[model samples]
Target: MTREEFIAAIAPAAVKLRLEGSPLFPSVRIAQAILETGGVIPAWNNLVGYKVGSGVLTPYWKGRSVNKSTWEVYDGGETRVRADFRAYDSVEDSFRDQDLLFDLERYRRVREAKTPGEQIKALLAGGYATDPDYAKKLDQLTEQYALTRYDKEVDDMLEQLMEQIRLLQEEVRALREQKAMTEIPVWAQEAVQAAAAAGILDTTTGGSYDFYRFVTILHRLGLFDAKGQAG
Candidate 1:
């Protein structure tokens, strides 16, 4: 696939993986996929050139693999070698399976990386690829394509979700306050009963706290006689 086609095919899964709390940044993930496959998407759906290293089969990868010719750098020299690469049914499955690798102890730094650059460094430190210039290549791809925009999109979405949650909390608090205002408090319950008994109050409910206090004070001053009239 061409660069644009490859990005279009993988960007959605990359963004979704990041938004779902994968520590890998969407920009870095997309750049990695581009760099790993050189913008030529493999038919097996292995977007990031994942290998069948001693990893156990999971729901995302069902122990299927393909043998392919790949390049590896060793001792400052590059050579084409045949290797076993894990295959997936879909691009999303490949992305998810790649994320699952981060759960390993060796990839802890990758998980803790907060920035795209930091993630690249962590990936390099963890021996994700044998290429000495892997970080630089990934960086170039990320900058050239403006892939970080996807990361920003995820951030904006999360902020909007948080704002919605805050609004819901405010609404809940307002309802609680309204309920408190309409309910009779223990301090004003006796006055409310007296008013109700004297037929001075149509109902002993739906009054604000201040209104209940005012009625209690008037009752205490004996303003209403037993006939429900002012004394």
Candidate 2:
């Protein structure tokens, strides 16, 4: 299928799932689809990044690889087992499995996102991909494909989540204040002393300060090393 056709077929379901679950999956799915199939659609309808094994003699046989190499199996199964991967009957199955795979616990954070953008951002922040610019690339894809057009219904969802986060932060701050008033633990005193000695914390509030800012101040005083590490 061509990119346009693939989007037409899968984008609706992706939008529906994103609205129901998380927004990030669609972009990741799109990127993976492109990577696995070399387009927004699969060449042989193999949507799940499946690899064929050496034993498969079928015409659709792409290539081969060992299925399970580790020896942790109790039955002492074949050390180099070969297996056939499922080639999907249609593009729909591929899209379906894409959603199903994201539902797995490994992607729980992205799956739980309230919006597609939030989900994509969370995946990047959570280290879903090693690429340092993964989030930016996903955002570019989202805008390029106009994926957010399908997200109009959930436009305010992110705002609501942000408000909820703010309230939780306030509650956490109140709890910490209560804890602080009740005790000045030895560890806390030691931390204060260390901060004062390192000049990285505010002595009055006993709040941990950013070391980079301290380093910048030190650098102005000619104390920073050439590499920006503490001198």
Candidate 3:
């Protein structure tokens, strides 16, 4: 796939993960995929070069692996070696598997980072990549591609979702309060019922608290009675 197509295809998935509470920013995620695969998405769907370490599996990664040659920084030198990298059925699953890695306690700083730059720094400090310039390279990619726009997209979506939730909560509160207002209080129930039976009141529901009390007082004064007669 072309560079733009690759990014277009994965950006939504990355944003979705962020919206679902993945701490990683969409920009950082996209940059990692670009750097990991050199802007060419592999058919195996390992966007972030995650390895099948010790045959451990996550819910997103189903123990499938492919033998690949990868470069690692060792002893102040770059060395090429064959390794087992985790494979996924789709790009979204690959992104999800990466989220599982960041969920680890050791990557707590990555999760707590307030910005993409801070997250990149935390990833480096947490030994995410062995190369000394790994963070710098990712940062360059972030700026060059203006990938941070995806982060803004996620923020906008989250804000809209929160507003919808707030409106729903308000609706529920109003319904509850309205129900409370329409209910006949225990102290006024008998009097209101008497008033209704005598035709002194047309309705027994939806009266304000004060109205109920007034009806009860009239009933107490024998203005309306259980015999369904007006005094």
Candidate 4:
């Protein structure tokens, strides 16, 4: 996934964790998503790489799961094992699970930590991850992209931003409906006008203008004629 896509996907989860009063910094959690998922947004929606200790896919999980061969490392070294990782109905559910992990006794120090770095150190100390440099990697992803920006965006602000975006999309949709082929460049406009005059362009509409209709018009006028296939 692109950096922008990664940031957009995790922003809501980070903001929710912050608003819910989780002591873990948003950057800490956002970086965890990036590092754990290898920056790819999976269809399973397991945002934090949480694994199910039990191998079975019992109904108790309340979500789907996929078993994959995973690695485990400690001071003794590394070992590979197939494990069932937690699945979610959405990324937000997995994020909520991450917060629950920090509430365990092993991560008490993390809850008591003040700085982001200290919290990461506490997680490493609690053996939250198998990698020896887990803290350093989380820190690098946090600092390099300033993921903490999501921490400061509260729920109310997020709601307001989403509403504004929805309104803007509506406005753009309305504008497109009122537009005609005359709005195009002169060369393109003349071509479209000729097509319209020839009855190749479908002027009969149920008061709607969608991309599919536009493509159909182009095809009827012989403007889109590609015979190749795309994957």
Highest-scoring model, lDDT: 3
Model 2 local distance difference test score: 0.55
> CA shift at 96, candidate 1, in angstroms?
0.8
User: Which pairs of residues collide in candidate 2?
Assistant: 23-116, 24-120
lDDT ranking, best first: 3, 1, 4, 2
Off by over 4 Å in 3: 191-205, 208-231
Q: Write the per-residue lDDT of candidate 4 for residues 60-102, one digit (tens) a residue.
A: 2465788977787866688898888887777877777677777
Query: Candidate 1 or 3, higher TM-score?
Result: 1
By summed lDDT, which 10 consecutive residues of candidate 2 come out lowest?
65-74
For all predictions, the C-alpha RMSD in Å is 3.3, 19.3, 3.4, 18.7
TM-score of each: 0.84, 0.41, 0.83, 0.60
Give all candidates' CA lDDT scores: 0.87, 0.55, 0.89, 0.72
Task: Write the residue-wise lDDT of candidate 3 on 1-231 in tens digits.
Answer: 788888998999999889999888999999999999999888899999888876777788888889999999999999999999998999999988888888889899999999999999999898889999999999999999999999999989989999999999999988876876778889988887788788767673567777888888898898975589888
Residue 24 error for model 2, in Å?
A: 5.5
What is the model-wide C-alpha lDDT for candidate 4?
Answer: 0.72
lDDT of 1 by residue, 1-231 (tens): 578888888888887878888888999999999988888777798988889998689889999999999999999999999999999999889989888888988999999988999999899889899998999999999999999998998999899999999999999989987987778889888777778777768653568777888989988999767766655
Lowest lDDT block of 10, candidate 3? 200-209
